[model samples]
Target: MSRNWTERDIPSQRGRVAVITGANTGLGFDTAKALAERGATVVLAVRDAEKGKKAAAKLGANADVTVQELDLAALDSVRAAAADLRGTLPKIDLLINNAGVMYPPRQTTREGFELQFGTNHLGHFAFTGLLLDLLLPVEGSRVVTVASIAHRIRAAIHFDDLQWENSYDRVAAYGQAKLANLMFSYELQRRLAPRGTTAAVAAHPGVARTELMRNSPAVVRAVFPAVAPLFTQSSERGALPILRAATDPAALGGQYYGPDGLGGYRGRPQVVASSPQSYDVAVQRRLWTVSEELTGVKFPVG
Candidate 1:
């Protein structure tokens, strides 16, 4: 593998199908573009169908790109989208759980889950579980989840009040959600390893200039633009880690990919380590159980 891996290093994706959430813009759009350019049939699973269509249009007529309605904030929408895909597609080569919320105000999903936790973690959990069978039988199938550096900042699985019913701190909620994304990937990989057909991997964009941070604190939103050029990379560059995780033949289950720069802010993609707490097997299992209970979705692997 190249030390400074970029989109040029991606392997051929011909004849494969990639389903990416939040594929309308930002890192997700870049990932979809790269795969489509490499001959993969890309499905831009997004909350807004119009935006998704516009995004697919940007990929040009030569690209085999389609749109699927998938609002992670609502379990009903996740189920419907999964069902639609399962009904249409015979198999899926890549399932990228990439859509997410950042520092939004105190809010909840349709199912009453905290906005970040519900959409970022639990939504993907249900969606993945509901669609795992499609990837399980296919050779070299992968479930590439996008996590974040926030997993290491003020993050923990607060089992006592998982939904922040009593108190709400947007930053902590986002951290917990991102951390859960990592934990879900690791735990899912552990379960899929015995099967040896589908692999689960995680990646993070570092500090990419994207709309995900639109809801960030006012100070950050105000100051981020001026310093963004120095501190952040383009969405295309930020998508490298995710593209690698989804396409790199050398990538293995339970592995993570992120930027190679200082503090993982910007650079080419490389294998990276997540926070220590994300490796806790006990917590991972517990979170899985809780997710299943909350979403009523169970994986075929276990």
Candidate 2:
């Protein structure tokens, strides 16, 4: 509960098996790198094999790491990767759903769903469900879903138009996706509590300098790039909340972590609360059901 929780506070991860999506760059890379250094066998589940390999290599020669292709934008790819992971790993101590897309041009995923919603929320939703069995049997297992401060913006489930077929606002869509991430974590935690086999927690990078911002608008692109270093934290620092949510002994299920600085833009990791909208039980359950229906990947647990 200290104010200055850093990566050094992460407990020894020896013998643990971790699967981190989008581990090739940004917060995911730093998260995977830190865990691998702490002795966890990490699988950098990425969309590109070459990038994953390069990322693995960056962790140094001795880090127990490997690459698994996981393209969250595609449902078939998510299923295939999950199946492969289940067959290979006997147990998973940590499953970090850290991959996401920011404010990009209007596009649909392979399934014809909105790109950000599909990749950021639905993709991880399906992947986690497919692999929940692996974590369900392991004691102390944790599922860390990476959300964002954007969830507090113009976010809603948008059930009537989940794909934004009629209209699209990049920032609003991104907010919906991020909001769904937090909702998924809370709902998953509720389901996991009874089984006592795993915990679901959420963390945010707190405005760190990462490649996820490549989709920013023209004005933001011009100004953000120049001002980022002065205001934003490094990706390494951004990964702290994630690492903390994954390894902090005192961290509880359904809890959220982010930077403790003013407006949560940058600082050390600490337990932080999400928007009240994120905790809406009705919306959470509805989204869960809708996600399962869309992905056809029902979790083994209730």
Candidate 3:
């Protein structure tokens, strides 16, 4: 509800099914571990099945965990993983779009889109759309997208060149993907509100010490070590916002959650706000339409 929200605040997830991408490490692993410990059947949906298995095995001796192969950079992989999940999971109570690429060197996905945008935004878009029907009919079902504070730094939806084909700035491109994440959640919430069963919420880890920063610039990479202890929190703590967005009874559609300290850097989870551009309904709708067109995956809901 306020500061100090932790895994202990998570309700009994007795029969819920959760599918978390990039669950092999960092925030995703912590999220999956917490949900599994709370009695949910958690699927560690990851690009690397071997790492996923390792991560699943560490959850607990008795945790209900499964490893599903999902490569967010590859559209075919997304479809294949979604098809497998469709056959395996009857209903998914939580869908955490937790996996993402941060500041990697310029690269393109197998689909020829920029790697970060393709993996971070469009892949989850297609996966969620493909699997949304399972959640739509279930009460309390939620989709919690993990965005980042970087979304506010320098982010925008580049409708003219969504793939960053003309020019590329890894930082701004990452921002675009993160911004798209929030916009997607907001727009999806608008669509889900009328559906009467599912809700879409967004969250950020607020600069936790995670492997997600491995691709950052050399200076940031060099400086992070010295400042980490002073500035960053652990991945376990970083995961609280996501856990709250997923399980907190009062968390509502379109709500965004993040840390509550030091410009949202390191503290307990709380309901936070995102950038003004992230709330633009027109832009959200446009991105949604373009996403559907690009990914060839359409949501079952309006």
Per-model TM-score on C-alpha atoms:
0.99, 0.98, 0.98
lDDT of each: 0.95, 0.94, 0.94
Instruction: Score residue 277 of candidate 2 by CA lDDT.
Output: 88
Q: What is the lDDT of residue 47 in candidate 2?
A: 98
> On a 0 to 100 scale, what is the lDDT of residue 186 in model 2?
95
Write down the worst ten-residue block by lDDT for model 3: 1-10
Encode model 3's per-residue lDDT on 1-302: one tens digit a residue.
45667788899998999999999999999999889889999999999999998998898789999999999999999999999999999999999999999999999999998999999999999999999989999999999999999998789999999988899999999999999999999999999999889999999999998899999999999999899887789999999999999999999999999998888898888898899999999999999999999999989888
Residue pairs in clash, model 2: none
When sorted by lDDT, best at the front, the candidate numbers are 1, 2, 3
User: Residue 287 CA error for candidate 1 (Å)?
Assistant: 0.3
Worst 10 residues of 1 by lDDT: 1-10
lDDT of 1 by residue, 234-287 (tens): 999999999999999999999999999999999989999998899999999999
Model 1 residue 100 distance off true place after TM-score fit, in angstroms: 0.5
Question: Which residue segments of model 2 deviate by more than 4 Å?
Answer: none
For residues 160-236, what per-residue lDDT tens digits would candidate 2 score against the true structure? 99999999999999999999999999999999999987999999989999898888998988999688876689999
